[model samples]
Target: MNNNPFCLPVFTDKWIKHFNTSGQEKRFDFIENVSFVKKSFLPVYINVGKNLTKGISYKFSNTGKDFKKKVFLLYDVPDYFELDTTHNFSSLKTIDIQQYPGYLVGTSQYPDITAFKKSRFGKSSLAKVNKYKRKLESSFDITYTLYYGDISRETYDLVFDKFKELLEKRFSEIHVHNNNLDPDEWEFYYDVIYDMILQKKASIYVIYDGDKPIAGSINYHFDKVAIGAIMAYDIDYSKFYLGFTIIHKLLEWAIDNGLEIFDFSKGKFGYKTQWSDQEYYFSYHILYDSSSLLANLLSSIMSLYFRLKVNLRERNIGMLKNKLLFFFKKKKKRATKDYKISEFDDTIDSQKFSKVSFDVKTLEYLKRITYDFLYSRSEHIRDIEIFQDLNDKKTFVILGKSAKQKVTFE
Candidate 1:
């Protein structure tokens, strides 16, 4: 009976960081346990033992080892947003569809921000500050609906196919080359995701536009709280503002269903900030066996260096781009001179507005930032508060004071 606790597999360094930051720790003795995988390898799975309530155990696997980690770590954070129990949509009179033409504009048009402010529900009454702004448009006849269900074999296959298709199209558009997964591996990945979603009581919402699937989102419900997961929209209907419409519909559903928190997940994007009034701090952890000290130390040192470089580039380069855009706009305005200044200014403003008004470039930039920085960083281990002592063959558990208690172990 080899009594050595197996080192659980981790999918990414990000997951390792998440485990470290989650504030729970345990040591498993490896008496009857043996692991075929090494912690240093990519896609390391660490088995902690059996879960009592859910009858499900825990394992960690890293999907990417070399990719640069996104800065906005949503998966590392605790849920800080409280569910609003008083939200009611039926109380407000529904506006005629013919009155609001800009309702279904693309996400790049800042529809999410606009809708958040304009929405009659989910507004905080504590302060009189207005968050949403009004947009000029006629009414749209479309109404976004929310749909949720378990991932069956058919649905799972559909989602997996859609994800691959979307990933390939996006990669090609960006001119990036990456290896595609074989059918078996792809199915395995989907199975893992599907299992996790079920354990988390997750639901998928697909918003339709006249029977066509325009946008989709995955949401997880824990207790009375719902966390928004991966969301994407069809590129062809980018001008339809499907993302915002879907979000609004989901929020309404949350309120109606008595779900408390609607976590936007992790990121500090302009739109997320505009709608969300709260934020939770998050951190990352790095752990390794004491026997493998040298290897772990080297990996940690390299990871720290890479992270520092990334932070510097994001701050400095991002600032430089903003400054350059500001100067260009200033110069453009300064170069404009005419005898009829008011009339010329009006004409210029009209022309400039018309040229840029329907431009979804800004929306695309927001999506890119959110997807790269916020959404990508959210893939990590969850429900990892316990560990099995491999040395003693007994389950070592860590207890906390409160339901949302924060605990850390080395």
Candidate 2:
């Protein structure tokens, strides 16, 4: 236990119970050492926790050939993690079953965020992110707060609630389901995270517009590594490119606080790839006793299944499935357009659009257009005015200090 170099919080008993547990609680074991009995129903249940499992760093040892399970499979085992299963099994099969790339930023390597950004990203990319940050701050009372090791229960609840709301709204627009918001598991998150935060194992970085959380990220920390766990931004703020800004802020926090690695775990998203300096793969470690025919058969079958799945993902079948869902969901929800936005020149028309008193809550759909206008034009939120068309209920206009946008619906 003292010799274990890996301090991944994912392998902790609490994380395993909350994130990876199904009906197979009895099958999984860990800590001083780790082990998992394969699923009873299927020996080929290879993806036990494909996306969620960040793997462990321990080698299996020979226990005088008294293996209860024919085959042992470990997934998401990062290349950096030390593992030598040769002592345990003669027929060990290591497969590069990484479905998506894993990334990390060596925060300790750079003195500060600016230097880190300068070294990792080109000037244009850095400038673009900076522009978004500037625009966001210009439009609102922006506050960047980091809550680690201490936070009031009330503020924690409020931030998490808003985080879930933003996640739902963002994924809804793109027609996808976020597993984090699943009702069955969300309670675990709400309950577990607070104590974890107090224990210094968890963190929440929030970008606030006054008291409201517009963007946020929850990260897990162990030793020097900080895992970028969950992140969400209000879709209404999408035009400001809050994703880039949130990451930049998070990186800044991580570096300032002495986190060595910012593990952008298990994703090939454009942002992750762009920000990453060190690249590693999550692989499957299959150990089977050569004497056991059942073990060999099962491990081979499981390995083949993972290879096939990875191949399918490579061809972008996942995107195809999402597209299909988007089509079906759009039809099921509503084929009609909620609103349409276009550029227009301010002019006197017979319909006669007039400025109206409104708040952000009045027309949620208009928020994106308004933010986009702020991105392109030099105007603050206070200087902007919303207008309604006298003749058409479906038509409206948003007038900024120097720029205007036309909003219409059918």
Candidate 3:
């Protein structure tokens, strides 16, 4: 049995069982126990043992002695791995490490909530937060609660349902609702949440407007670190900034609980930096067994390929693509300016002050310069309507009027 912090047999077994299901609805189909694949010539497994969430340690388990198939690939391993320190492996051939920066909040950064609040939100942020709090309180009675220990069965189900609903709602607004996942995936998550709660290793924080729960977060406690698992809030209360409020409340809870670290878990979103003092990084590695010359050669080739790919990816290739694409877009826009700009209706429709009507072709063109030329005037327009002109001629129209609309693009 592996004695690694993440390799606890009891909890790991439960984790696997919760995620692994041999059914038609295979959400976590790629997850397999490392022990099961140790005998294969080149066993590929993620460095994820069951504990860490953010930096995925992906690697190939080269425990098999078959030298004919020497080169193995482990895609995403952490940078902190020291080969000399890691033991119990006999056939690990060669390793190539690629640095992937991951961020985490350090526990020792702040002594207390006051210091954390000052550093995280800045000086005036507390006043703004209070303003939002007061606004929320004016409408409804507001209360915050963090649940730990063995929670009631009823509360667990309610929290689970509300959290899932809020997540779906939030993602739907961002047009990523499909990624919110299916029922089977939710069931798997339900099992893990239940297990964590039953073990008294989970902390659930809820914000209630009167008796109705509006926002909540589910966090897991492992060792001295508190890992934020999932957080969601009612979209209706988005104007009040409930999400930020809940997370701020969680940090206070973390300080009070004597937790050493509040692991924001992964992703470098701006909100994560609101209270984060430091970040931890991880690496990706591709390893090979060094039994044969051919194996060594193959490993070297893969190492080069992976290194090049990671470098290219990390060099902001997407930004380059956008720039090149924008250059061509400017050329196209300049060319299209020669086309006659027919104004269909320049009259400000009093009934349609919150709407903009334009042809599909005009809308597509507007999107290019909308950020630079029209962003400031966007608030004057509420809804956009694209219509097909029967005359086969393109027309651009600004259907609304605002005091902010000082320039006319057409």
Tens-digit lDDT track for model 1 on 243-350? 555666676666556665576754355546545545553222223332344544544664475466447655665456544554553422211111110101111222
Query: Model 1, which residues run further than 4 Å from truth?
Result: 1-37, 41-152, 163-189, 196-200, 287-303, 306-313, 316-410
RMSD of 1: 24.5
Q: What is the Cα-based TM-score of model 1?
A: 0.42
- Please provide TM-scores, in order, for all candidate models, with all chains considered together: 0.42, 0.82, 0.60
* Model 2 spans with C-alpha error above 4 angstroms: 1-32, 35-38, 41-51, 61-69, 84-96, 185-188, 324-362, 401-410
Best lDDT among the predictions, by candidate number:
2
lDDT of 2 by residue, 250-330 (tens): 899889889888888876889998888988877766655556677777778877988898898889887777657656655
Q: Residue by residue across 38-149, what tens digits does model 3's lDDT show? A: 3234433233222233323222343533423444444334443333325345655456565445445555567777677776675688777656656655545679887776
* lDDT rank order: 2, 3, 1
lDDT of 2 at 41: 68
Computed on alpha carbons, the lDDT of every model, listed in order, comes to 0.36, 0.71, 0.53
- What are the root-mean-square deviations of the candidates from the true structure over C-alphas? 24.5, 4.2, 10.8
Q: Is candidate 2 or candidate 3 better by TM-score?
A: 2
